[model samples]
Target: MLHSSHEPTDYQCPFCELLNDQPFSPDNLCAPSDLIYRTPLVAAIMACDGFGNYGGHVMIIPTAHLEALYDLDEQTGSAIMWETKRVALAMKLAWNPAGTSTRQHNEPAGNQHVWHYHQHVFPRYADDELYRQLRHRVSVEDRARKALELRSALFSAEHPYRLTDTDVVR
Candidate 1:
């Protein structure tokens, strides 16, 4: 039987395996209150509204806990892509950004923390003031509030995608 909590031994990547073994820490993990929707492949959560002055920031993360893109199997990568599309579609429908920016970074030098592979989806407005200051100005409390708001929005039955437990396939 496949053990849900144990790291896969044949992955070939140690960092990826290490991520699987790491204990779940709330500080390292984004707040659950910020969670919008979840699936076996990924979870969508609000990234905090005041972050870049326009709000509507979302992150899509693979549930498998791979540390970086290189650690994921082809199947997992494909699933993450599909989930990302779903998130982008939901963001566009709900927040209506003038444009959207998707970003991914790896390692400390790359400004990545938490050691998990994730993609950032930002809803951008044309004249947002905080655009240039995003790297330095996002606040945790604001992010938490945004996350809660997003969670409330996504949980509504009228939301486009009805995410369920079965959506998360191993």
Candidate 2:
């Protein structure tokens, strides 16, 4: 089924470019090292921008470039949700924040910046002001450090999700 796309005719999807290893553009802040979890169907990467006091938030996206929620398939959506849960669990183990939250935007009116369908997982604290605060670009070093933290917590012996061949990126 052909779905209507909101992107411009010459639009270049940053997520697709990043996933495909296409020519690097400074506009895309995501890096290979920022990937904390990935499978054949989906990937969870550290967002370059962080909200409020938190840094190293994660976004789970489908491996295939589906433009929006309306364009997503069941299998891919399930994969994204699975990764989102794992990332939330990892965040709890890693940071021990008060709680965690997941957010997804659909179109321009919904504040969806990227055309690709993705879900964000954030660690929330009492006064984090996640919605009120502006997003700022986190340092590359900080992102890498947080990625390591999440990766360690995600694959650690204490976590329920073990590193199986099916779940882990090889």
Q: Which candidate is the best by TM-score?
A: 2
CA lDDT, candidate 1, residue 99: 70
Q: Give the Cα lDDT of each candidate.
A: 0.59, 0.83
Instruction: Count backbone overlaps in model 2.
Output: 0
lDDT of 1 by residue, 75-151 (tens): 77887777676666656656667777777877667666545677888777777654465543346676666666555
Model 2 agreement with the true structure over 1-170: per-residue lDDT tens digits? 54567777777777777677787676776777677767889877888898887777988988888878998788898878878888898889999999999999987887888888889999999988899867899888899899899988888788887555567665
Clashing pairs in 1: 40-168, 48-143, 49-55
* Cα RMSD (angstroms) for every candidate in the order listed: 7.4, 1.9
Estimated TM-score for each candidate: 0.65, 0.92
